[model samples]
Target: MSRLWSPHIESMKREQIEEMQTELLKKQLNYVYHRAPFYQKLYKKSGVKPDDVKNINDLQKLPLTKTGDLQAEMKETGDEYSGRLCVPESELLAVYGPNQHPMPENPLITGITDSDRNTIIQHLARNLIMSGIYSGDTIQSLCWAWEPFNRVYMAANLLISPSVSEILGITPVTLEIIPLEAPRTFATARLLKPSLIIADIGHLTQLAAICQQNNISPEEIGYKTIILKEQRILSEKETKEVSEKWKAKVHNMLAVQDNMLYAEDCNIHNGLHIWEDAFIPEIVDEETGEKVGEGEAGKLAITNLFAKGNPMIRYLINITAKIEKTPCNCGRTHSRLKPQ
Candidate 1:
């Protein structure tokens, strides 16, 4: 069997997470300063040396690497858009250049050619496996993989791998991934009748309706549990109808492209266990870029400590969530995240 993080840096406690991030953050900055010429030039012009980024508090000194900056780099330079690439072109595993932009000098530069994004996923996947999810079970999704949101794909890879790690409870690590798209009723009935369905209730409703129209029994689909993505609002009628139809309990998980899904505890209605072990979370005022107090809702900015392929430090994700005050009843001291 393989392993998650060798010694496993995936499921470290909150305290350990902070200490580890602090160290990695420093190394990341130093790396960018030395390797990425673009960032090195910026540092020279700003009179802000990379060493000046002493800690998370001083991160503000480094200008936020916005999409526009990335664009400017791609337009100006060729394959080496962010001359601040710490790893060499050969070492760069993948780049996640959103389709919103024009074609890069080289397509690969924009994609995660290096393992930076992979490293981040390893941390999150290990956490997901440890949180819940056994090897014997199966996972299904309506989402696409490796294109837009590679996190889901990365997660699937982590689960299906046979590895030994303290991060995830999955020792043997063998699972199946069934990607479901439109005309899903026919597709699912024919193929992925999985035990675990990772989609929202609305998605489930759509699936059920499709199945009913096709004359397939809902039970035949076999969804023992469903991972619910947080909804904007819930109607009483909708809630009641959902409860009676499926035999599974719905779990609302907090996930976003910018902020990887995590919470304060394994089970907390409001707070999502923050993956501090990989993602360094900061709740700041939307306009002012100032930190908000605990239990307050503010803009969410995440610094992926492990992402070397494509690193984002304090990149504004445009989410406002509150930090839960009390430690989760689940008995972990790590802080939790709840949407504002």
Candidate 2:
């Protein structure tokens, strides 16, 4: 089916997206500067006010937020929520601590307001549509690996599972394989005959290794599509190799623990289409903090448009990407990010 989860915004013109982002960015800055202490202090120190930022260009005036800022705030205040939370505990629907970089003493948890959580879920749904994943499709996803401590792929899958199943009515089959057990993974996939496979690059690589061991092609498993979620992009050679080996179409998606679904490739697979309604993406030089021209490579910066509890403004996501201002052949007007 040819459909967009949010047709109007997904098909918006480049100018329209920029205008919308400008409005959202202004509101977000004003909201966070007033409600979030960390942003308030940062903005004040940078001599930038909410009103000072009227458009995306004015974003250069605001200081970039680093992950260490949150940690430093937690260390000093002994309050995990002091820097990031805009609302009271009564208003928050969920609290999440970072799975990576564990600091037990001053562990900070981010509050997800009700609206924020819904935004995350809705964005994930949009990714499914953008990737050409449809309802009623059988999706085989990572469950638990043999090593219990390493559930990186499993955790990501679990996060989006509810939204996919509930909103799209898709059937999700999670595979839990014993450690060093390729046969088990192969068997599970064969039994399910999933049409779509959703997992991180590591898990998919492991499955590819299993395929070699058994002398069985991934195509024999019968999955038509594979979605590899990663913080970085795979090389074109690697992407082509995976598709050739598995006999399936491969799609890459960029996501982080902090932000759920940020960008995903359409069927054309040239670059990832930024979720324009949810995020305003910019490619910038990390040292100078200046916007890189279109088709230029630089660090990926994201501004969350609707996240109330934790507003991300000019936040450097610690990944490098090349921005493509040209429209995607798939008809999504959102800018494309080629993550490196």
lDDT of 2 by residue, 25-87 (tens): 888888888888888888888787999887888888887766777778878877777487777
**What TM-score does each of the candidates earn?**
0.71, 0.87
> Which lDDT tens digits does candidate 1 get at residues 229-338?
44222333443466457765445555544223333224334356565656667778755666788667887767666655455666666566767635555454455666
lDDT, model 1, position 315: 65
The number of the candidate with the highest lDDT is 2
Predicted structure 1: lDDT? 0.53
